[model samples]
Target: MVSKVKIYVSGRGQFAVQVAEALVEARHHVVGVASPRLRDGHSDESQAMSWDRLRAWAYPRNITWTDSSELRAHHIAADVDIILAAHSHAFIGRRTRARARVATIGYHPSLLPLHRGRDAIRWTIRDGDKVTGGTVYHLTEHTDGGPIAAQEHVLVPPGSTAQSLWREHLAPLGIRLLLRVVDDLAGGRRIEVPQDEELATWEPSMDSPPLFKPELIALPGSVSVDSSKWALHGQEGRDHSRPGSTA
Candidate 1:
């Protein structure tokens, strides 16, 4: 695969630095960043630590940071082939979206077309899915129904909480999977299959439901389906046995 390619990162979240670090490890040229302004607005201690980590990590990577609050002419004027989003809640307009020569990939945790909104990892566990995996897909006007480009499956470990599982497991996996997608795209492999709308599911960005975890150690008086515990669902669909097609 091609090495040392130019890439742009969008988002002010922890995932931004994680992807940058991994890409640096793989020797990719991080051109610049156009994330939303960091909320020096109000931050608690844990939030501070995440910010500290982001600061410590990004400094060495030498990424040009743009306060998305400002104009894009500064960062988006550069030549780049890939645009990567980590915790990017904003939609891409023509300017930033046009910078990429190849494609822009949005990374989502749930086997999307399923959980199409925020708190995907938390929602999947809350919903009692037996299997949920990561998906990397082309970004379009819609939330996450875009055609899939590449995906990697990860199982939620046992006795995991929403806070613990995401903070620990899925976050790093997302960065790794996205870099793999970048490598695949760099290889001139642009094969994609349309998502099955019949099985498509959508979750609202707001109004989250009560998370269920099969509370096994509960008292006998309240022994019902452990709605609080998480289980995996829809994993068998990932086993792609089909042959490759040329672009």
Candidate 2:
């Protein structure tokens, strides 16, 4: 039988709730959940899994929930085994990571060693990449620099948007990857593979300037291609179309 571990979840949005649900379904003890309160202008998915709704769901299941913008080490229980950061914007301190008995893992929308920053899905689409994926990795002080635990790739359909990619591909794949990683940990297995720093590429944050200017390519018969080939002049630009760009 797989041993159940004590887990603390920190994040907001549908992804976080999905992870928490999966943990509970796996019979893991969810000690606490720290998430931001719902606000206007939040994404539809996030609003669907707001703190208040999660609290109601969790309370009935005997899971403690807290509404906090950030999760600190002090917020965690003494016997917490793992801390899972799912779709969280808050930066987890090194001290908090150390507090966990097993590890503090994070879910990244892009494959590690590439697109290691905020708005990974947006960047992938902006770059017009043919493929993209998700990564479940150990969390460190450095952003998305932690060693990888599990990864899965999906082909980016032509004219795919960030929202579509996330909803259709990355989100589902990420959940499965996270569950597999948790199972590995539960089975007393170390599953970290060191990331190659030399091959790493960092994308601009979500609030940064647009990565590429869309160019409408006239294709045969009423079909047009939204190509990301036209680089926005006067910005730090890199050719993401090159090989090894996506997962």
Candidate 3:
């Protein structure tokens, strides 16, 4: 039998809510959420579901939540088995991570050891990469440098915008990998693979200017994907427009 763990979520936007919902569906107790302000109503059609949606979903169910600023500014005292970071910009410090019984896991929208930064999806498009993927990794002081828990590659279609790529592929991959990692942890079968630093590449934030020339690096585990079959349709909270920064 698998144990249902207590989890604290750290993130914003639709992706974060999706993570919280998945955890609940998996029978894990979402003890708390540390994200942005929880608005009083649903997000407008133009906007992806924000922290407001999370507020609506969590409050009725009695899931306690606090602002991400608190998590960033000071230590949180939640007695959680794991801290799951999904699309969260705030940093989860060492002291906070130490509170988790298992480990703090984060979802990054790129293959580990590559595109390790705030604007991974943007960099993927700007660099003209044909392949990219998502990673679920243990969180550490190093940015997106934690040891990998799980990873899967996907294809980047020609002329694919960051919004489309993220909504269609990376986001779903992130949800699947995160759940898988959590389940493995609960079942005592969690795996951790150390990343090769030689293969690692870090890019600047979206605010920074684009690189003049693309850097060539060997992608080992990437496989070609038939994007038509993987194409996802309308879903509530899906961000249609390109995001400024996915950090």
Candidate 4:
């Protein structure tokens, strides 16, 4: 078992909120959230204060909230262990990462360095990938490319879509992988796997839809898809127009 640690979280809502809940469940102190009002690409209207909803979901847990933008003004924590981020779209420059007690890790939905950018789940489903999964990795300057600390595989069923898969599968596994990584970091053991260059892939911002790729998707059975979406920020939110990239 690892010693208890003080954690300064970033972002709010599902990804950030769930990770905070899991950390507390694992017996760690969630010192405060570097709560960002906006999730990367969302409009200001959709990014209002959400501590109320967060409290509803995590009522019994004693937690604090701080503006993520004001991170420099706070008192430094004693034994600030590691960082857990997913849709935490704030800038965690090397300065903050270097100050932590453990790894400043992030979670990605696809096996990297393949599908290395956002919209991974969407891309996998669109590309007719029968398999895709989750990974927890150390955060570097790049997006999802980093030392993979731990990963778990998930099978993409035939005819899967981002919306359906997230509701059923991805979200749940994301939380589990986060807990495992937190535990491993707390225990001072980093069992990581470097990404394979040969298998590495990147998602361009303008790629066509999975349904757009008839060869890979239609070979077995053509699965019709809806590739239209409004812009949604936050590292890994589902994009119907495109699958989301990871944090």
lDDT of each: 0.59, 0.68, 0.71, 0.60
Rank by lDDT, highest first.
Answer: 3, 2, 4, 1
lDDT of 2 by residue, 129-225 (tens): 8987888888864557678999988899887778777877787887798888888888888688988776676664555443442211121222333
lDDT of 3 by residue, 1-247 (tens): 7889888887777888898999899999888887667543644634534345555566678877777656742344546788888877654667778888887888888888788766888889998999999888888755666789999999999889888889888888888999999999988877789887677876656564432211211234433444444322221111111133663
* Top candidate (TM-score): 3
Clashes of each: 16, 0, 0, 9
Candidate 4 pairs with clashing backbones:
41-233, 118-244, 118-245, 119-243, 119-244, 119-245, 120-244, 122-243, 126-210
Better of 1 and 3 by TM-score: 3
Model 1, residue 143: what's the lDDT? 52
Best by lDDT: 3
TM per candidate comes to: 0.72, 0.77, 0.78, 0.72
> How far in Å is the alpha carbon of 247 misplaced in model 4?
7.4
